[model samples]
Target: AYVITSRCAGFKDGACREVCPCDCIYDAGEQFVINPDDCIDCGACVTACPVEAIFADIDLPAEHSAALHFNRAFFES
Candidate 1:
């Protein structure tokens, strides 16, 4: 699972969607979200995000960043 963090927690410009290989990204109101099932973990959307908000579950460096996993799950469920 991956997440868009505070670094990329602003407007949902969808640059990530443009580069997503699996089309897993979803527009979640004010931000963008990734569907856990659809995401291939290709990491393509990470670089496409202008704010660098995207991160893999194991790569999050901060405690708050952990929320991305749940966020993705919630969006998918």
Candidate 2:
């Protein structure tokens, strides 16, 4: 799963969603989120984000780790 960090909060560019082969990326009001269960870990969205806000779960920066949980919560709720 890839998490969208704070840098993407206002961007909502949708580039990640456009290139996602699984269609896992979705609009979550403030930012785009990736559905962990549906994501294929293809790394396409990572490169598509102009803000460089997407990060793989394991590779997520310490400051942006909360984004991972936020992403999962979006799907859970």
Candidate 3:
């Protein structure tokens, strides 16, 4: 699954949501989050992000690692 990171918090370009083939992305108040369970891991959202905020869970940047958890929590809650 792809995690939407801090860069998207206020910038919410929403391009990712449009390109997501599986419709796994959602607005989480401040930013968009990808539904880990629904994401197909096809990498479509990554390229559509204007801020480059989307990253695969395994490839998440060190500082953005927490985004992987944040993404899941949004759905869980």
Every model's TM-score: 0.77, 0.95, 0.95
lDDT of 1 by residue, 1-77 (tens): 77766554556768989988888777766567778767788888887777777888788778656567656656645
List lDDT for all candidates, in order: 0.73, 0.89, 0.90
Give per-residue CA lDDT, model 2, range 1-77, as digits (tens).
Answer: 77888889888888999999989988888888888999989999999999999999999999998898889899997
TM-score between candidate 1 and the true structure: 0.77
Top-lDDT structure, candidate number: 3
Which runs of model 1 end up more than 4 angstroms from their true locations?
none
Return the clash pairs for model 3, or none.
Answer: none
lDDT of 3 by residue, 1-77 (tens): 78899889889999898988888899998888999999999998889887899999999999998898899999897
Compute the lDDT of residue 18 as modeled in candidate 1.
93
Least well predicted 10-residue stretch by lDDT in candidate 3: 44-53
